[model samples]
Target: MDLGLRDATVVVAGGGRGMGLAAARCFADEGARIAVFARTRTDLDKAVDDLHGRGSPDAVGIVVDVRDATQVERAFAELADRWGGLNVLVNAVGPDVRGTVESLTDDQWRTAFDDGVLGIVHTVRSALPLLRRADWARIVNFSASSTQRQTVSLAAYTAAKAAVTSISKNLSLQLAPDEILVNVVSPGSVASDSLLAWARSVGVDSEDPYALMAAITEHFGHPAHLPRVGLPEEVGPVVAFLGSRRNSYMTGANVNVDGGTDFT
Candidate 1:
């Protein structure tokens, strides 16, 4: 299907790795101008090269932490100055905080909000002007199904994602008049290096990421309808479609890309 994404300028915040990079790859394959943002210079550079290889000749990567408003602004400004405007902003930036309610400290909660909630706010705030420059604009924020599911040991992470969902809903209302669409995509257990690391951090031990995810989800009582955990490539195309012109008239909605695991 033609997504109408050719030449559309897009920013995948935290696109250096995992689903972010996967989403960027999908966009690049659709012939979009891709700009990825993340803190690690090495991952960002490598991702840019991979995108270029995937047919986005103009793909570039920026090193910026979304929690830093100044860095976020500078990154978007640079993209606008170079690309002449922006079309879509995929907020693939996320935070992974693993702790039970009683075990999680105040500082961990603060970090969760800072990285998950404020991260989205900061990038959106900085990219608004550039997005406005386009005739049509869309914003896709990454959220987790953990927020909608009944789970234990991931309270802090889910709390932060809940805020992201709420913020995107409210922001959509304000941006609608301008014809700017804002939506959130919530994913369940997806296989990626980040997911593996997160699982390990929370005390799930496995050499294989997918195995770890299965164990975690089974223990939490939310399992994918599909046989196994998902892949970044699986989630990427859905995001590309939503961010594309093909997805008009859908705003303020939270779309689940989680293998039928979540009702929300």
Candidate 2:
């Protein structure tokens, strides 16, 4: 499918690596003008170069920490100036803040909320004007499946993602008049670099994400429907489609990309 994304301007938050990078590559493959935002200059540049090689030669990377509203605003300004306008804003940035509620401190809980919820808010607010300029605009935010399912040791993280889902639902109604759609993609057991790093840290040396998921399930007592875990590429195109012109009449919906796992 064309997805009608050719020449469309898109800014992906946390596109430096992992699932964000995967989504950016998918968009660029559909011929979108991509600009990736991240804190690390090296990762951002590398992702941009990879996107160009995939198809979007004009793909660029911007260094900006979404936690800092000022930096996000400036980065969006630069993106709008370069592209003339924006169509899709995908906030795929979220740090892993995992711990049992009783074990988590106030600062730890705050970090989870800040990364999962406030970061998306900052990006969406900063890009609203640019998105409004387009004939149709889309916002795709990330929420973990644990928000709906039970994932032990991730109480704070799940809580924060639940907030993201709520924000997307509300924004969908508020932005409907502008023809801007806001939706959430709740993923489970994605094989992202972040997830892999966590797995390795826990002494799981396997390359497969399902291995990580298995370890998680065994340790946390949460069962997955699928026998295996999903890869970044598995979730990337789904996000690209949601943020593309191809997706019409779907907003404020929390679409689960969790391999048919429904612990509810």
Candidate 3:
């Protein structure tokens, strides 16, 4: 279970909080050197501190919006200068807009695409060169289970993530010669700050976020097999595994970490 990640250079997008932070911590625990990217300086700093405190060989936070290609490129360059080369790139950044096609505005659609799809495109493009230089590389994208089982109000989000899955599959073929594995991890119902805030925004009572989430999940999220919601930590280890040298043959695969929530 070594994962062979010790001292590896890892870049985690949207690593400031939630599942991204969880993934960063998991990598750090395995002795990886981490460079976390997010837009907020405060959150980025705190995440880096937390990672270092958790036993990362080295940890740095770069403030960069993944939606901005220039910023992403520069951040990757900085990471390369600091860590020498990249071995893992986790696309944990995502947009939060949710609604059906009729309820969503054009701007919302564009924003969703920008945050979910284009953000991955920009980050992968920026990091491809460094990844190519590495003896082994992995790209783990955070897609969603909703892409497999369509949600009623998550039209735009699902569409965007579906695009991410498609892109990862295509890139897997292109990066095969380089031995760079590209794959998607579709998580369901992870209790993150973002998900809690989103629940509150959608009229869930702040005092009982879990109650609200449980009610919703019981009705919509537990159709597959496991009758429960997943946790950030539960999803993080899988991502770390996918990014590790241990994962030699798996690529272009959409692995569901959804507590069996999509089996309907």
Write one digit per residue (lDDT tens) for candidate 2, span 127-192: 999999888899999988888776668899899999999999999999998889999888888777
Model 3 clashing residue pairs (backbone): 224-263
Specify the highest-TM-score model's number. Answer: 2
Q: Estimate the lDDT of model 1.
A: 0.88
Candidate 2: clashing residue pairs, number: 0
**133, model 1: CA deviation in Å?**
1.1
Clashes of each: 0, 0, 1
Quote model 3's TM-score: 0.93
Model 1, 2: alpha-carbon shift in Å? 1.0
Error of 2 at 60 (Å): 1.0
Give the residue spans of candidate 1 off by over 4 A: 198-214, 262-264
Candidate RMSDs in order: 2.1, 1.5, 2.1
- Using all chains and alpha carbons, the TM-scores for the candidates as numbered come to 0.93, 0.95, 0.93
Score candidate 1 by TM-score against the native.
Answer: 0.93
